[model samples]
Target: MIDCGRAKRPGWSPSVHYAGTAIDLLVIQNLDEDHVEDLSELLRTVTVRSVFSNPTVTASALASMKPDGMRTGVSTAHNVLRDFGPGLIGRWPDTGEVQVVHFYCRFGTHFTETNDLSLATFFRWGNFTILFGGDLETAGWQMMLRNQEFQRLLVGTQVFVTSHHGRENGKCAELFQIMRPDIAVISDDAIQYGTQEKSTQWYRDKVKGIPVLGTENAYGIRDKRHVLTTRRDGTISIAVGAWGNYLVTPEKVQNELTLGEILGAFGRNALSKDSQVA
Candidate 1:
């Protein structure tokens, strides 16, 4: 019920959606035409009810630019806040389902655009936490890693959606060591981005180490509740509607798997004597 994504370019209409049917809660991550697109039609077409975005230098620069260019983005973004109404977008405090909002309230050394200033959110149910990054990259990640608030707020994240589709620009080893999420979910359609094998392997070997689920890999295998990368072509299903679009939940692996279970398998000592780096 946030910003809805629409046809920004050809081939891909938006993420997890079809051009006319899918409505994404467009949390504007950046102003780079790729990430930011016409919101008026999208919001009205999808009848999106709300939105959330990080107030970044993009806003500041837009403030300085022509009024016509900034009107829709600012006004639409503002409307979401005004209508977030008296209650927060998260669940009631005591509820196990928690959607905590993390903002870049302060500026970074080179923070610019909603992209670098993209708002990152997390959902925590029990010990399981899933992060949905609105495209935050190196500068943004750096800001987060250095901030005391961010550090305290992000001590233990179970999963992360890597920013900028795991672009080489922001793949900092330190960020990985700090956040240390057990899994990384990259909801990317690689055809548009280019070869994903190399980049995917880079993070799998060095950063996430746990397991990576790409929208590209589509299949399900369950063993001891561990993550199994599958070929994700027809297996993944998505539905678009005025209310919202739904993607079929990734199938459980052949063996039962859980975050903790996977972590256990990767202990200092495994079935074998020890683990070997790829």
Candidate 2:
């Protein structure tokens, strides 16, 4: 599991329960509340084998870095890391043959900002590769790009999860020069900040567009999208085959169903309930 956060919904614990699988590893990429809010609840509900995060990021360090001082989630994240310790690096058996790589800036030496200290994850399964840049800013990405190994890893990234929820601050034009992904995904809510709204086009321009299923515009025209967001698409799922071919499916698509289809489903449900009663 990566970054435990919740909004109006009940968070990810319910899904974990329903799936009936214990978390082999929980990767906390950013120390912010939105990234670590449900840490305590998750620990209580299920058994997590290990946790992967920046080792230098202590609760006190995080609190001092933030303008608002300590938050409950940050403290909880620190405690979990202390108790569980850092997860091992290498292939995880639970996740099949997928390989994982973690990247982060050193606390005082490389970055003063907490966002730069965010752990960046790289995953590879067969020819499929994806990158999750957890709130990492331009400077942080620039530093990582200097590393030859990190550069090699970015070469074949098919999907790129935008940092800082696709905020303008996280945009690193230099990084995209080397890493040309097929699609970019932003894990964000409604547009609350100007940075969130402004960077959409920039990200879209960076990636090559992918064919999206069940998505159509208001004019009833279906267009291929280069970017996808949680705010627009409820939940996005990616299934990769053995040969690295993949399919991207979104939980909700725009104009996917008409009013008549919705009403017909409701009518059918009512009839089914009536039949049960009879």
Candidate 3:
């Protein structure tokens, strides 16, 4: 799981619905509260094998997981490119092997805070390259563009994860020119930390003819209806095959079953008739 969290605005832990689930690896791209809320509680529920992130101001936040029988490490720029560089990360259940290309500004760069130190990762499964920009902002993007090692990883990128929750300051038109992604995914909410109008407009004009997908509805944007939001479209899933062929689907969340409906179903069952009478 990458950046396990809900927004830090209201500051609520995730529901217990995932109590029995197991997380093999947890990738904390940024240590921002919004990206890492409920991490303590999350550790209590699921068993995480390892945690990876860039060494940054807030990288120490992951220390809690170490005592929970989990291995955690912060990657330096040289360490990333040398060790976890453009190579096989893992293979999907029924698809091609996934390769991750890592890049960070640990040496000389403009980044001094957590967001800028966020690891810029390129995940490639076959020919489908999905760039996970973390929360990298303008300066960070510029830094990556200058790094020759990072440039080598940007080849054939088609899907982009919008940096800094699609905020205006995170916009990097030059980076977009290099990637030329078909779709940009924004992990943000409708109210706080939402995608900015300027960012969306810039992408539309720069990229041209690509859908900007957001996890929540963002206000003050043109062609509002065309912008795909999770609030309306539900969870979006992209499946890629061994050959790099892909399919994108929006899994709409259905309404929860009412108590009355449950009772009606139980009553209709012959097996429950005796129990009801008893």
Candidate 4:
């Protein structure tokens, strides 16, 4: 799992229950309350093999830096990291053809902010490539860009999960010049803050638009979207095939029960009842 933040509408508990399997790895990107609020609950429910996070962020350090309310979540995260130990920095196991490379940023060195210290993940399965920039901000991105290996990994990223939930602060033009993805996904709630709303167009401009499933406009035309957001797209599921061909399917779609279809079903039921009576 990428991040285990709690949400009222699209909670992770239901999906985890339905899967009926233990989580092999849990990657905590940001140390903020929104990201780690349900950390303790998640640990209690599932048997996670390994956890990957910033090693420098200890419970005591967090308690001192963060507010009082964030103590519980921080404690849980700290305990888990201490117990499991941070997962290896290089290639992860059991992935088959999928190449998974985790890039770690040194905390309390160049940057001390939790967002800047976020872990960046790169995945390449066949031709499909995905880059998850955790919650890294502009400075963090710029710092990572200096690494030649990191730059090489960003070459053919088809799907890029926007950092800091597509906020303006996460926008890095220099990084965009290196990695141009087909679709930019922003995993965030509805527009509660200005940061979420302001950078919509900027992210769109960064990526080449991809064909979005079930997003036909009013004119019966399927719209190609450059950006996909949890606020609008709900749970976004990307299924990549053996040959690297992939499909991006959002949970919420434009497919609704039409009046004509409803009436037809009703009429069919009525006819069946009449025949039975006869």
Q: Residue-pair clashes per candidate, as listed?
A: 22, 0, 0, 0
Q: For model 1, how does the per-residue alpha-carbon lDDT over 1-278 read when each residue is reduced to its tens digit? A: 32334332233333245335633244555444345445554655454433445544433453433344545545554444455531233332332344455555334445534466566676555444556666676667776777776665566665566666566654556666666654455544434444455556666654344322222234542211112122332122212122221122243421334645434434422333212111
Predicted candidate 3: what Cα RMSD to the true structure? Answer: 12.9
Ranking by TM-score: 2, 4, 3, 1
Better of 2 and 4 by lDDT: 2
Instruction: Evaluate all candidate structures by whole-model CA lDDT and list the values in order.
Output: 0.46, 0.75, 0.56, 0.71
| Index of the highest-lDDT prediction | 2
Please estimate how well model 3 matches the true structure, expressed as its whole-model Cα lDDT: 0.56
TM-score of 1: 0.57
Write the number of the candidate with greater lDDT, choosing between 2 and 3: 2
Error of 4 at 211 (Å): 2.1
lDDT per residue for candidate 2 within 101-218, as digits (tens), equals 8998988888867799998899999888999999999999999999999999998898899999999889999988898988899998878898787798999889887644434478
Q: Model 4, range 1-278, lDDT digits (tens) per residue? A: 77677765655552355244577667777877677777777767676666767666655545545554455566777666555554443334476787878776676666666788788888898777899988898989999898999999898788899999888888899988898888889988777778787788888888877654444589856668888888887877775655555656566542453546433433433423111000
Worst 10 residues of 2 by lDDT: 269-278
TM-score of 2: 0.81
Model 4 whole-model lDDT (C-alpha atoms): 0.71
lDDT (Cα) of model 2? 0.75
